[model samples]
Target: MAAILSKIKTEAEGTLRLLWKKIDPNDLKPGDHIYSHRRYGLYSHHGIYVGDGFVIHFIQTETKNNVLRLPKAEKFAHRPPCPKCLYDEYKDLGVVRTCLDCFCCHEEKLHSIRYFVYGAPRVGLLLKKSGTCTTLVSSRTANEVVEEAYELLRSQGFGEYNLCQNNCEHFATFCQTGKKLCTQMSFYHDLEEWVKRRIS
Candidate 1:
């Protein structure tokens, strides 16, 4: 998906922008839900933009080693015991903050999804792609969303990462909307079942 964030754009020529809008790196705002395709859209990773060129996200321990391979952010994480950032502390699967450069480096292109979309709920259905836009509205403010992510990272309250039950998308959506759900996982799960039924 070719999506980026500047602000919500609508259908109108000069109005707010909607789904799949390509935006400059400077456009991302705090608490914005962003994602990127992984393995040719087999799945997408999700995270919350927490301002100051940083993003908060949930990662599995095995993947953490891979993430560490990315070029370190300007002001975060030294090889061992970086005093400025919490690189050493997040040893297992849980929330951690990293610069946008490191987060976006996981994939070739980064896409963003929005919670509380402007148009009707049916729009989301039409999009058909999970980890994109959602019709549900978020009750929390952007700052509140950012705060929730920080709180979770600080407290390690999200629990172990589970592909079926709990995952990164769940962590991000929860912080943005206070709801823990992963449409991406559900989308694939249903597709798998449908394929099984089709053949057998």
Candidate 2:
């Protein structure tokens, strides 16, 4: 999709500035909701609109070699706060721009969905068992899966585990080996018998 945030209005035109002295990184929230058509990707709601340029957001750099770019904002509420300096220049204007089209949100969704059952409790249960992090489900690589889960572990007061390069190798090998083993096992299993009967 396009990187453009949203439709800008003439009324919203003016010099706008943002300061993040008080805002914490954790303040960023997801805007995407369940069951909405456009709710798939754009997840987090926090964004920082530094004037004279584009709005800023953080892409979570993952341990598994992926980036979930989040929409970063200086002012985050139901409505964008009209700064005092911008009021004179843009008070009479219409909506200039909105914080949307978040790449991080989209990426986060991708990371979440790859392993988890879409919007299911089983997904969380499985991920928790497999030591995966919680993210918006969509499509993502296996490495991003475990790494995201590890982040969650840390946040939950679990002691930070040393990130080892071997973990990456182990992850790739385990996934590959597991798939191969399952494929091999399927040939001797009841699933194969069921498929053969359906075809016969």
Candidate 3:
């Protein structure tokens, strides 16, 4: 049993090492945009790393009404409600700061179905571009960007979470630049193009 447990631990560590290799710990700076897409290719989530192994991102939390409803619904149904069903019924919670470990631990916990990391272009491109294509623009120093993000997080203090106008990507970009933008918009736009191409 001891040998079996040791082998399992070794395999888990090895898997983590492989995952970490994809991301350079040295390159992670405060205010840096970290993004990942859902496994189904529908959407993405973004956050600003605030250094010291923490990330600040907008998260949706269940509303009081929904919380109140769950028990009654479950009692009536004679079984627990589906997690996805509960999530669909809940309201947005808002911005939150969490350790990177918790943030990336599991997608379902975050209410994301599944997620995989991907490289994001420089913050400048995201700020300056209003369309699918990217263009260079003036960039802030890393320190300045990080400070801005921290300040915003402090000032905002968990405001509403709006998927279209305000979201995790908006929060990250706002920290990097004073602009609010959604990266998922481009994904949707591209998807629209793909569908149009297929139909036409």
Candidate 4:
């Protein structure tokens, strides 16, 4: 039992290294921004890693936007509350710190969402499919990112989690870059405008 429990966590890494390398949950450094595709790759849940296999993230308890849905039956699960984080404690959307296992849920893979692509690397990444990474660069150092995450966890200063105005990606990006960004949502908004223009 002990040996199995101590086994290497390879299943935690991404299977595809096409653009940004899939991150191993165990190898995550403090302040690393990571995410996992949920709801069949429709959207991802983002967070900031604070080492020790823990992650700080935002969650909107009643969000119905993302196309991600939970079966009604699981709402009445017989399981106990999570130990590492009283995950059940955050009944409302706010900053919360949880172990990576809880953060990623049952997902086998994770991605480092915030990355700097430059010069030749940018060329290769641009050639890949979208949603794989972002071109935004962070001016903040790792320590700075970690500091902000902890601060928000304590203050819940991020306000209510909104699927658009503010969200998980926004929270993690704010920690890592000291600014909020949600490119995917931005992409959708742009696409919506384009459709309207064509229809008009």
lDDT top scorer: 1
lDDT of 2 by residue, 1-200 (tens): 23332322211121011110122223332221111011432221222232222222222223221122335422322233334322221121211222232212232242221111122233233323121222224343544433433343244322222223212212222222221111112223655799899999
Candidate maximizing TM-score: 4
lDDT of 1 by residue, 56-119 (tens): 8888845554556766533344345324444443363578887765565443354443332322
- For candidate 2, the TM-score is 0.16
Q: Please, what are the lDDT tens digits per residue for candidate 4 over residues 21-103?
A: 66655566886777776766577788888888888898874533332455664454444557877666324347888877677
lDDT of 1 at 87: 48
Candidate 4 Cα outliers beyond 4 Å, as residue runs:
1-20, 61-75, 89-92, 106-132
**TM-score of each candidate structure, all chains considered together:** 0.71, 0.16, 0.56, 0.72
Kindly indicate the candidate among 2 and 3 with the higher lDDT.
3
Reference-based TM-score, model 3: 0.56
Pairs clashing in candidate 3? 60-93, 61-93
- Each model's C-alpha lDDT? 0.68, 0.26, 0.54, 0.66
Ten-residue region with minimum lDDT total, candidate 2: 11-20
Ten contiguous residues minimizing lDDT sum, candidate 1: 7-16
